[model samples]
Target: MTPRKGERPPVPEPLPAPVVDAHTHLDACGAKDAADVSTMLDRAESAGVDRVITVADDLASARWAAEASTWDSRVFAAVAIHPTRTAEFTDADKAEIERLAQQPRVVAVGETGLDYYWDYSPPAAQHEAFRWHIDLAKRVGKPLMIHDRDAHADILKVLTEEGAPETVVFHCFSGDLEFAKACVERGFVLSFAGPVTFRNAAPLREAAAFTPADQLLVETDAPFLTPHPFRGRPNEPYCAAYTLRDLAALRGDDVAELASAVSGTADRVFRLRTVTSDLPNGEGLR
Candidate 1:
């Protein structure tokens, strides 16, 4: 239909492209309403972020993420009780988590681990909850997405003692280079986030530089830790491009190539079967 006088023209359609965002909190990013989620996904799609794994750290958010996924093709959900929120977990929580793990759209078992920096929950409770989540991951035969903040040693010790699922990912990895090496050695995938693009994040950048291509992944961790150019702004999936650029620079590879590599790693770790591209290693991104 032709527009009337003084009417603005319609926006051109965005080019269809494939990109994967390894981590983000869909429910925590003001997407609590259906309209908000639709708008958020629309922006993501316009920016070429084809798929995103929405991580929920508690039962309420988990249910929200799962329900949101059912409404958006590009959204998938990961449910777990975050370390900080572990104090809220009860026996009912455990049962609910087990039942949620069986859902088709729910792919991984966390955003769960130890966070010493913010002792929102007691250390002992965090430890117990962390182990329980790990056990749940093993029982469900799914990958685990872990969050470690200033508790790398404890996290490593727990993973070693209790053993992680076959597919374990250190999401938004902020550890030192030594820990990065340790994680790779332990067969854990390290998912870098916007922090890697920060000027003072030398340790994170160093870890990014040395991580094996196959063991590396990328995420946005949106609504927090937005990359340099957008550091103080509200982060979203599109900002992952800056992270991709930084990672490619760190590895001295093409941006598209690095994106392909991390996308493949994410697909494998998340058990996604319909990714949009293939890795340089000749493996399907899925």
Candidate 2:
């Protein structure tokens, strides 16, 4: 059945092998509590997105994201004050993020980098916060997930200047082939999102094709950037299956092979763990 205007695109068929939604925003996707989180993951699981990393964009969301990870084994958390939201970033906020970064279910310190497209936060503040998050990721021994927008040069320069963490992910990577090559050279993982499937994103497609399999990952960045044939409609983690399948077709790779590569890359970069009922809940988080 055809989806009508304003309706979400139907869930795509499951991948031959499960893949991770490398980055998403469950809180923004209307996941208000544990039950909502479970429901969202259930949908994602049905579509072959067996796990997700819910990223935080602000203090409240950061807190919520951390707690939400504890609600489900399939959901991991990445805590940070988004670059655009750093205008009034406080020390207390930094302290809390640091505390949350240590949580067992919190997989990375991320979605933190530059967004030159928006004027919501001053460049100076964003730079300062980016540096701090970089340091935090390094200190916590976790991958640093970046949110680079129109500031590719600055993002690379800053990471170089501050010394990048052991593992760095360009979350929802939006760059041309040149930028992709540069990130590839630095061993930085590029996580493609729904926009890569857009009609106008030829350069993005080229970049995605160019990224090495080991450094390649896929994501939804949910509630935004819904894939082609569904652009402008609301997005959710389940939509990752659509993006992954599209990526396979575009790159001329076998769906199962590419899905396996992406899943392994996510596992390596994020150091993901399968959450079990016996595992401590929200351990080491204050």
Candidate 3:
């Protein structure tokens, strides 16, 4: 959970097609400066990980993600106060996040939701902040990205009660098939991370299989949850190729088809408009 060694994992081979690292902390992934962000994108692109949504966990990060989205064409942003940081979530913080949500490049209004795995923030505060973010997402007309830890039922309850935004994605989804069904029925997208590629991640694999191609997504959650073989090493967007490959094998699906579906879903959900050469003449921004 700390430094993943100065020497990060080598970038794997390119995927059959490009995909999105739906949720990653580029600023926290040894990419603190603008140059670092650009270099990271260059590396990611080489592996067919052409686009990324660098997410922010706190106010400072929210600002950085907003700015970073503008630095490189391939990078977009997701702004939020992570649940652990929700204890300090204030009116001012909410106001700023609301402002950031309106930015063109800030595609999603979260990575915000319930997290009972830690006691850094009390449940009451978490609930209140979660509701605020849900409302914020609705008001701003952006997708809501959730960070659900061990609080599945409560997360679902809050979304149901407050009413969800037009688009909702459970970043680093850790739910079982039943919970997965609940989210899908509500039109929520489940994003599979490196954990889905593990031998012991049968529950997650089941959820992946149950998730329709249209409702399915994948992420690196980079600098953490690196997929198997590279499990505890370190992660980056390029490694999303590994997870995509494994997911295809797990579900008995075609890799190229899966890649196309995931990338297309991300472009649609996040409203990415990367002006990269990867796009044919007047092809994307969907």
Q: What Cα-based lDDT does every candidate model obtain?
A: 0.80, 0.91, 0.87
TM-score of each: 0.88, 0.95, 0.93
Of candidate 2, the 10-residue stretch with the lowest lDDT total is 277-286
Stretches of candidate 2 off by over 4 Å are 274-286
Who wins the lDDT comparison?
2
| Top candidate (TM-score) | 2
lDDT of 3 by residue, 35-83 (tens): 8888888898888898899999999999988878777778889998999
Query: Where does model 3 exceed 4 Å of error?
Result: 1-6, 274-286
Clashing pairs for predicted structure model 2, backbone only = none
Lowest summed lDDT over 10 consecutive residues: which window, candidate 3?
277-286
Error of 2 at 247 (Å): 0.7
lDDT (Cα) of model 1: 0.80
The digit string of per-residue lDDT tens for model 2 on 1-286 reads 6666678778777889999999999999999998899998998999999999999999899889988887787888999999999999899999999998988778899889999999999999999999999999999998999999899999999999999999999999999999999999999999999999997999999999999999999999999999988998999999999999899999999999999999999988887854333255645322
* lDDT, residue 237, candidate 3: 86
